[model samples]
Target: MTLDEQLKQLAIEAQCHLAKTPERQRSLSRLISIICQSNKLVRPFQGQFQGVYEEIYAEAQQRLFLYLCKEIDRYNPELEVMQWANFLMKKRFFIEASRDLLPTIPKGVDRSRIKRSPLEVLEKQTPIASQVNASLTEEIIQCIQEDHDRLFQTTHIEHKPAANFQYIALQFLAGYSWKEISEELDVKVVTLSSFYGRCLTKFAPKFKAYLSQ
Candidate 1:
């Protein structure tokens, strides 16, 4: 049988075995192994990361296993299970690759070139908070919001950030951890962190001016 036909057969068998209490674990394990071993699933990332392909492939398999376990009940026999599995595996691969490939800021960069965290900047202004009028505080916040919107526009023109960059930044401003943002946004934590770094690089000067004012 062809790969698709083989996958359909496996899906049928897997569902049947899942329905049986005694065979469920064994069948699931076997099915996961079969899926992980497919050339089509593993070929995309093979030999791509130099010495880390094995590591990435292992992580991808682990992620795929978890996904399959969570989504087993929702599996539809009418659809191609292998295709779904391929997509999940590929996504996991890219996430792992992104984590491994995220660039680091160079040491000895000027402090002024680094953007201050919004929360940190806000905290530094606390001593002056009592002296400032309410309208002034509101205006400052409005100015910061405008700066964020402007960065969002400029970055789109320049770097074309992932679609969720704005939401990620808003969540960061609201004091969410990268882990929390990852879970809430269905994005990898590393990807969000990297994107945030890029945003800081581009927005540092404007943010620094805002903080100074």
Candidate 2:
């Protein structure tokens, strides 16, 4: 089969694996293991298709797994197996990704609670919060939103999948070191640095406005 056809087949197989019911769990487990092993056959050609292999395959895997878990949940909401797997995989990814990017922030310190000081902004901006309080968190919310929008406008990321950008941002938020991010994301450290610098440059003005508020 052609590469495209192969990828399509992989997607279908992945969907099937993820949708396996409790009665078929063992069979599905063996099937997915085999598929993953077979797919690794392309590892030798990774130098030629690194980007496609990593980004495309990673996305496919995520979608397949998510779809499977979602399907299982639909069948039996009380079944915690799929949910546990989903959480475990997601948590590991976040922890591994963050371990290499930014410093870990302590919990319950008000990540979304905007602090006006330069020092605080320096620290808080590491893991950008998704939601800020409408009243007390308005400053951060507006600034991040503005900066995020501007970055999208200025970059070719507008053409890329939104999930790609979000994934990159999540790495930074997870406090992954730059080198770790480079390795994890399969990009050069310089590339990650430049991308982040662009984000900060676009975000700075908005951050200032937020502080002013």
Candidate with top lDDT is 1
Candidate 1 lDDT, 1-213, residue by residue in tens: 776777666556656753323234334544654554565564454444554444445444544554465346567887887777777666543444335333433233332433456874674344332222211233333554565556553453123334344555555544454555566656655555556545544554454456466
Query: 2 in model 1: Cα distance from truth in Å?
Result: 3.3
TM-score of every prediction relative to native: 0.39, 0.27
- Which residue pairs clash within candidate 1? none
Candidate 2 error regions (>4 Å):
1-167
RMSD (Cα, Å) for all candidates, in order, is 21.7, 21.6
Model 2 lDDT vs. the true structure?
0.39
Q: Which stretches of candidate 1 lie over 4 Å from their true place?
A: 16-20, 45-48, 96-213
Write candidate 2's Cα lDDT for 120-176 as tens digits: 346435542332111113344444445555543344233434324335554544445
Model 2: lowest-lDDT 10 consecutive positions: 128-137
